[model samples]
Target chain A: MYPWIWRHLPGPLPVRILEAVVLVAGVVALLMFVVFPWAEPKLPFNNVTTPQ
Target chain B: MDPPTEVIAPVDDYDDEYEDYDDEYYEDDDYYDDEDEQPAPPPDSTARKTVRTIGELLITAGLVILLFVVYEVYVTDLISAGKQDDATQALDDQWSSNTVATDPQREVKYDLLDGQAFAKMYIPVFGPDYKFSVVEGTTDKDLEIGPGHYKGTALPGEPGNFSVAGHRVGKGAPFNDLDLLNSCDAIVVETQTQWFVYRVLPMAGEAAGWAEKQANPKCAKVSPLGAPYDKTVGQEIVLPTQGEVISQVPHFTGEVPAAQQAALMTLTTCHPRFSDRQRLIVHAVLTMSYPKAPDFVPEEMKES
Candidate 1:
């Protein structure tokens, strides 16, 4: 069972770590750029001509 | 075999019987009786509490409405009371000076020049009584009168545009029939001063030169061009500039005009009376001016 688990593993340890790190960074970026601005009242996001 | 015991018959003494009875039993009975005499709480105490709460709520609501009414009526009056006192004092002074003895026709200053003062308007013919007021920024306040002028304006008697606006339906509805003013109908401003009569000049279609609509033939139409056209040389038109004539809450663009417009009186209101879709504008020219002061000459009074 141990040999089977090792054989079925998708990638090296560094690759897996990079994937996890990228996923968490994307989520944090989405929250900061989209969620926080839309929710907070004090932000002047709507007044700007561009979406940013 | 039983042990032999001496049977001594104890005497039934009254002192021994009294000693056997204890005072604690009587004391406990008396305490229970006292507890029973006290009354239970009434079941309707909650109802009484509820009634008191509702009464308090009603008093609070009444006080809020009373305060609103007081603020609307008496508070507004109190704020304007100082201005009113100043006007009354000025009127009293004007009366004592008998200034009319010199000019015989001095203009009276109208304080608190608001739409509220002009509850209605009258023109004698067409619709004799229409309501109008000195709407803020939209219309001329009491200061704009006659060939004479108020210092507040851009220029004194050299009229570009001197206009006033008012409501049509609400607040006594001055200019209710403003659309009905046609050519040749006499417009009269009845005041402490003489009745200033105005004649409605013919505006051909929507684009007539209304600035040149005064009764005085000497007042000529100066071209829209400035100084190359000398200010002192050309005859003065009494009507205000047509573009400057505005009828809205926040009136006329903040940018003051460079050229001399017409000396004009523009009365306007919301079209269709109540709805604010379109505007009805009536422009008129000063035909005659009068001062309705006491101790005036008979000839001037007849003309007025």
Candidate 2:
């Protein structure tokens, strides 16, 4: 699956590497700021207060 | 994948030089391309592709779970520390801007908005840097910024339980080291105009321990409480269902009345570190309170 993604990335090798880095960074940011914050309460071990 | 065959089918040609891609990171994809080497299909080729695909999926799943742990343990602490700093800055601004006051008798204001920080808590045993802003609400969002005071509970230095809640592990875990507190240790709370010093009560599992605690020189400032509140221990692990722990008199289980009550403070966090199965409750009573002067710092804050 990663190979297919690499083959289809719309750039040369260096550009593709940079794009991959940016893409990974974007995903990390999204998870850190948006998705993970939303999903934190649903997961165990985050409930520090009662009725967790 | 089949719908994108027009785009993906051409990748099989690239997969012929799989070493180039394998040198990068697509080592798993080389196995799928291995099947197309012979003109006709091998009997187990399809099974091989299925296994490889499942393996790739499992690897992705493992990476995702690892990322989640990183987010929970480190990233959340970083984020919450920044937020708690912002809250502290806001509190400082709020406290400094109260120069245009009306009644001098009213030192600290009690009417605070949700998530607004009203006081700062210091656990001396945690270190000289051990300080946390005590926010108004105990919601997950509120505690994310700092230790949160339960709504409707007594404010700092009041005649009822000034109960607070904080995280034990992450989200700037203000009470993470709560277990370190012992009998007669001080928990100082600084409001806008006054500093209230509360000490952990004797942990005899009953009210009878206060008389003995008061005899100690270190506990000289730590006052003894009357009937119901004397049962409150310095530290107790109780089920989360015990809302009475934050009541007017902890463990008393009585209706909210305006009668005179003990001036106590309770700090609660999850027990056993990361688990929320039970709550580790630490109760302290207000032993002394004095006006906050510009040059004054609480003595408890200097304890190593």
Interface RMSD in angstroms for candidate 1: 21.1
Using all chains and alpha carbons, the TM-scores for the candidates as numbered come to: 0.35, 0.81
Q: Best lDDT goes to which candidate?
A: 2
Fnat for each model: 0.00, 0.54
DockQ of each: 0.01, 0.36
In candidate 1, which residue ranges exceed 4 Å CA deviation?
Answer: A1-52, B1-121, B126-158, B206-243, B246-262, B293-304
Instruction: List model 1 lDDT by residue over B128-241, tens digit each.
Output: 332122222232222111011112332112244334444344222445555666554555554444455554545434224545543434223212223322221111122222
Model 1 reaches what TM-score against the true structure? 0.35
How do the residues B1-304 of candidate 2 rate in per-residue lDDT, one tens digit apiece? 5678788877887787786766666656676678567557456677887887789889988887789889888888999999999999998998787763344765545658899898998888778788999999988889889999988888998889899999888787788889888878889999887899898887755345566766776588665455666567789898877777888888786664656687889988988887878899988988888877779987767865
In candidate 1, residue B1 scores what lDDT? 25
Best by DockQ: 2
- What's the lDDT for all of these models? 0.41, 0.81
Clashing pairs counted in every model: 27, 1
Report how far off residue B35 is in candidate 2 (Å). Answer: 16
Question: What lDDT is reached at residue A1 by model 2?
Answer: 62
